[model samples]
Target: MAQEELKSINFMGWRKTIGAISILLLLVSIVSLAVNGLRLGLDFTGGTQIEVGFAEPANLGEIRTLLVEQGLENPTAVYFGSETEVLIRTQGAMQDGALVLIGNRLEALEPGAQIVRVERPAAGQAGLSQVIVLDGVSAAQVRDTDIFDRTYFGNVEFAQVEDGLAVTLENSLDVAYTNRLLTALSEHANTDVELRRSEFVGPQIGEELRDEGGLGMLVALFLVMLYIAFRFQYKFALGAVAALIHDVILVLGFFSLFQLDFDLTVLAAVLAVIGYSLNDTIVVFDRIRENFRLVRRGSPKEVVNFSLTQTLERTLITSLTTLLVLVMLFLFGGELINNFATALIVGVLVGTYSSIYVSANTLLALHIDREDLIPPPKEGEEQEELVP
Candidate 1:
């Protein structure tokens, strides 16, 4: 009765055409992945990150320019939380304390005091030159003026400048390159800035994260295939798995082709895509399995096509609603999650297409039939019952 009322759509009519397009798309995606690769974020590339807030709304371009001028290589500056906040990331100086700031000399002096150079012997066994020069003051007073006295050339000097008392300090290669940053900002913007957070990710840790992210995707695929195989026939499981792989690779192709930042959050979105696509595939597969038993008179192609037609409305509604939410996230979720939401947006669209065409096409190619889904009756059991 259900089969009689159902209207059949010819999904298989253009099977060859759809299959060719899908294959060509997949090939293009693969080529893009191989050629362009992905733009990895600092989470994957080792760097120093500093989150800071300004007294007023910040200008990212000015901040970036300030950092670049200060000898910070490849500095990336963006708004972190709000317009008033900025996050700066950079690969700092190669050597520790390489860049040193020398402040202007102090001109005003007391009546009894004179501005004089001092030489203080290198303290301790290092025998380094900790120099300070004074004409009248004791060694202690002269030691106080020894601005450039420390080892590795680390020190701070305060002197009168045209604007105000300018600060001179050394730059640390670590995330706390605060001295040079503070000096530069004070000289340029003259705004009060507060450090919110600072961190450094090492190269070894970044490599480990990249490796673990890859492993996580493989594990997710294996578990999903296992579950689907347990719930349905091997053929159905194979089709679903193939569809998932298609979705993942195609989404990854988008990332690689566009050079989107692929980070941990984006990796999480890919895993979510696998589950979401599998669910869609399962819905279609379940309907096909049911129709195979009830509409037993038709070929597998006709049955599969009818099954797809019946569920077409449900599939469209689900995909559309999900896409709406993803679009919102991509538009308003801020820079931190922009890549994450973009990955999901691309994945959902591709996942829907794969669920409808790739999975069903794979099943048709496998020649799925009623016999594949239904188990054979026990030998002679039906005959014995009929005799009885």
Candidate 2:
């Protein structure tokens, strides 16, 4: 049998240089986070998220500008699922009849644009169910319960039931809340708007979510450290934990430096990055431990190089294949998940680097000798008595 040939690349030979580069980038990221901070999305800051659709592609910048002109606070309009769909987010709770104002402004911007949907944080199993019929009645003529007061409907078919008007509403909301949004559109522009969805979330809930997200990440890291320590040597655990931390910091830095929307989704991605970095580090560390026992004569650095070389192809293939999918998602998965995909892409790239440089380098710095990984037999060991 022939040993597989490998590229004689000196990974450890450039350790100091890579370390310096990593440290510098981390410092820059910390500085950026302190100065620029992150752009928090509605999920973190507490606000309303309204999803609207147009008969054709509408201008996002124009919509944003128009919302601002209407005195909406810090309105952000971005493509939702497609160019024809836009999701608008506003900071703080919307003022009374704010939804109507938004619908009016949207109608003015693009006559075809309409408030197809609205979503707020759910309160509970609270809603309305009613049946109403009216003749020659405008939306405003309906009572508060007869309009867009429900986030969902069992049936809202106008074609199936015909006469003057027939509506059987289930789990509906107050007309003043979501219904007014619809009335504003139909009344002002005489445009038919569909009530897609609506809900409400308060700032206190956002704060709770923000705290929970941070706590979740901390718990994940602590658990990873404990698992690695029990599975291998303490030094191995330290190396793996350090690598995970390095990957996370780099990912967070990327977000902060770019001022990307750091929402709950991105926080989930960071936790995922920790898992990926730990997996890669564990793979290399396992090989190094095996080499310490089998190939008895080499310094820790030589063993580290050999282990990395053995696993290099596997690492590249896994990382590259995962990255390929993430690239596709970022390019074509639409605006709903672009940030999530972006976070994963950056994590895979940096996680691979940390597995190689950060984790292995920590083992070397810890002076991991053969005995640390593979214990020596006790001196003058006596054979155990056999039960005959």
Candidate 3:
């Protein structure tokens, strides 16, 4: 691939424009936090979630209303991940017994409301092909279950038993207390229940998670800087680190501002975004280094502009494709993926911007040079090809 010829762009002139966009996004993120507060999942804020399937399509409003009728005040009813199931969650649940009763009542009200079916029958891979089973029905009974199935990772709550689909009652919570409740529910409902999936992070656990996540991110940034500093220049590493931090702060601020659940998954996504941003920054840095070696007349800022302009089309294509996919997920993928999708959407936007502006700008501030970044060709390496 032919390298892009250096083309000086008025980067400094665009500073105000970029700053304005950043400020606007920052404010929008803050508002998203303040108003439509983050819909944290069970992984972050500890709570109980119950998923019950109806024979018919779940009417979210009706479900919540039905919950209210059963004395389940303020029970949040969102369509379960898959299957004809609806997930209801409550906080600091002092109403475990009631939910089972409610479950039965719903079954009675909506006779077709059976356990949500989300079983994939193995063809030859496991046993059969696409043998959809009930929440936990065996492969043999899958045909019986697949009469009406349309989703992956069938409706079985994670780790929940086949006797009955498990409900998330609390994340990082009191296991014994919850287990007793589960047993009582199993018997009361005359349903075999396993502790399928339960995410209960007590205040202590939540705090620990937050602390550890924060610490881990810092460690990652430090490590990335060290690695880059060795491979390139301290200035380049420092710039990359700055850009990475910008991505993280923006992601977290969006979460905090929205009071979104800062769960483990979200944490993982944030870390992944950092690496992603770094990868992009590294690409641009590589370009800048190569151009610096080939053209000795331009300043660092000029090299950066040329590098950015050269990669502009590729970056746009990649980011747009990713954003397009994420947008679809955000709109049609349902509530379970809402936050994950949301996090990705936010992270992608910020990561793209930081890769170009923040990362390169920081490098300029540090007065980076070709030798500091890409030392002259070593013995046999023949100047490892700079990324196209």
Best by TM-score: 1
Per-residue lDDT tens digits for candidate 3, residues 67-164, read: 55444334566776654566666553423334344345445544544455324433444322222112433233332342222232233222335554
Residue pairs that clash (backbone atoms under 3 angstroms), model 2 = 118-197, 120-199, 120-200, 121-200, 128-171, 128-172, 149-173
Q: Could you report the Cα RMSD, in angstroms, for every candidate shown? A: 9.5, 10.8, 15.4
Better candidate number, 1 or 2, judged by lDDT = 1
Q: Estimate, for each residue in 1-388, the C-alpha lDDT of model 1 and write its tens digit.
A: 4446656888888888988998998998999988888777777777678888788888778888877666665677878879888887775332222232211122222233333432334345142333322233333433455333334346534444333333333322232346546656755767888878878777778788989998988888888888878888888889998999899998898988888878789988999999899889999999999988888567888889889999889999999999999999888887778889998988888888888799999999998888998877899989999994
Choose 1 or 2, whichever is better by TM-score.
Answer: 1
- What TM value does model 2 have? 0.73
Model 2, 75-127: lDDT tens digits are 67778667766676777654434445535644554464444333332355244
Predicted structure 3, TM vs. truth: 0.63
TM-score of 1: 0.78
Return the top candidate by lDDT: 1
- The candidate, 1 or 3, that scores higher on lDDT is 1
Worst 10 residues of 3 by lDDT: 167-176
Q: After superposition, how far is residue 229 of candidate 1 from its true place, in Å?
A: 1.3
lDDT for position 132 in model 2: 40
**How far in Å is the alpha carbon of 304 misplaced in model 3?**
1.1
TM-scores for all candidates: the values are: 0.78, 0.73, 0.63
